[model samples]
Target: MSQVLIESLSATIVDLPTIRPHKLAMHTMQQQTLVIIRVRCSDGVEGIGEATTIGGLAYGNESPESIKTNLDAHFAPLLVGQDAANINAAMLRLDKVIKGNTFAKSGVESALLDAQGKRLGLPVSELLGGRVRDSLEVAWTLASGDTARDIAEAEQMLDIRRHRIFKLKIGANPVDHDLKHVIAIKKALGERASVRVDVNQYWDESQALRACQVLGDNGIDLIEQPISRINRAGQVRLNQRSPAPIMADESIESVEDAFSLAAEGAASIFALKIAKNGGPRAVLRTAQIAEAAGIALYGGTMLEGAIGTLASAHAFITLKQLTWATELFGPLLLTEEIVTEPLLYRDFALHVPRTPGLGLSLDEERLARFARH
Candidate 1:
């Protein structure tokens, strides 16, 4: 008789146009495509997860198609016979047996946890060492490009009671010019809020210094990825001199990167994304590194739908020290949701779902409507 054999793993690309346009230095969009991966055990237990492919391939070096194909053609084969519950063993095997594609690896990892949790009738957060916060404080994004338009967007979010923290996108314009725009938005919001900025690899060290000085004076809470991600010299330079605590976004992708960043005193904050860091356990390890170093851990998003959003939410819930506000407002950015019960947000807070597994239920109807092909 055949043993528990490797079965099938599959992916779907769901194109969800944002209900409102979300702007970043790389691109502006009213829509996003999520690479949703589903893996099954031979006995029919299944799990679902998401990988976000940003910027249509040109901007972020990834796409939904690439993430899905990597999972189906490369990663899934390695997991076919492996025990689904042994995530540590699975990850070790993944490193030895497969190559590096962190985003793709993360997508499959999420699915595995989803399957494992469902089998035990537990939420993924429980498996991650239980939860600390059932709800997360969310930040609203100030649209990029136009300063006045961004402030208007911020005001709109405030009117709707949708957010308490505001993240401004800075990078398309020169550093000084960008600060002018940033100042305009921050001033518009007045004394009632906190502001942060994501440079998105748009500035150099000198510019980072000047801009951070101005934003810091204007009450900016932090400066995210002030300089280019790949510039170690710049990371060190900015981390040492910048007035605002520097946060790593485009940089710090792996445990090695996390160790390097902390060892070199590259930044005061670590921004962890499940998609970029690869999976929950991987990000958690990174979190432990940050905590040991007395650094702040901030959860980031990739503008994902419910699947990826909830996956990150589960991880964030279990984290012992997520000291900074989170940007897990992907569902809010989308025009619609594909979850049966949406992650509830009130007073700028998002409640972690209490359901079992990754704690999300997909709406098949929405999937049918959004699938590009």
Candidate 2:
């Protein structure tokens, strides 16, 4: 075994246009900003990672700007001379100084894993306890907020055998309006697709109370984060009352949050996101907690590009069960790809890379084309 010393670490902000505006409860995203992390080792091997957020600050505390600043000003300095092969040690060094840059940490951790996997001649998934499955069923988000357009899009995906699980971004419209849209789409798709909704914590308890039952009655598979994440009492009430399974997304940020939700019986399902739970392995810890508490698993996305998406896929493939599938169609939403070989999506599932590392290599030309600088 050779000790690979970290020689350099850099973060770049890349702005890529989306195929269309992605509407959410808080903000509409017309483009995706990625905080791309590149780590080079003494052995001359380089690994790539990404920290991506939707609608920038509208979505979460970590923005592309903040991720880049934190990584360059603080985290990257800590990692410069460390042993890249000792990923835990490298991560711990950052944890001691940093508090809540989970997105940045995720990016760094991903790059570390990619480097280690390449060095070991294995895929990143193998390094993460080996993959239990090679391919993951991916879900597409219908965020156009147009009933007819969403229906048509879902039909097209189903017809093409691309995505059978559809997640509608609701709660932006009025309760009645959102319900009508959801129901209409569900009715149109019929049993051809599984329809779910992510409220993104837009509704109050009262609104969720009514909407949950209505959606449940209409055959919606799940309702995600109907109420705010802090409203644990509301979550508990909704979990007990709603016929549709309540999934906690904004609620479960860390392992501690997962335990709290599980202990309070706040939710029936948890949306496992790599950036939210710190990194790939950290999210796995959150998943383990959810699994022990009997909460169903959902592989959520931050609408990541290739680096972050594959980092997530690597971790998700190791999970024993993903009941609600995944929304890892992040890269597909972008107009351009930064990876040389884009992730393979077919038959309604995203296939894991068999190549060493994250099974990805950056397209420098595309990176230069989209680079914010």
**RMSD each, Å:** 2.0, 0.9
What candidate 2 gets wrong by more than 4 Å, as runs, is: none
Each prediction's TM-score versus the true structure: 0.95, 0.99
The alpha-carbon deviation from the true structure for residue 195 of candidate 2, after best TM-score superposition, in angstroms, is 0.5
Distance from true location, Cα of 373 in model 1, Å: 1.7
lDDT of 2 by residue, 112-180 (tens): 999999988999999999999999999999998688988888999999999999999988888999999
- Pairs of residues clashing in candidate 1: 17-31, 18-30, 19-335, 106-278
Worst window of 10 by summed lDDT in candidate 2: 53-62
| Clash count of each predicted structure | 4, 0
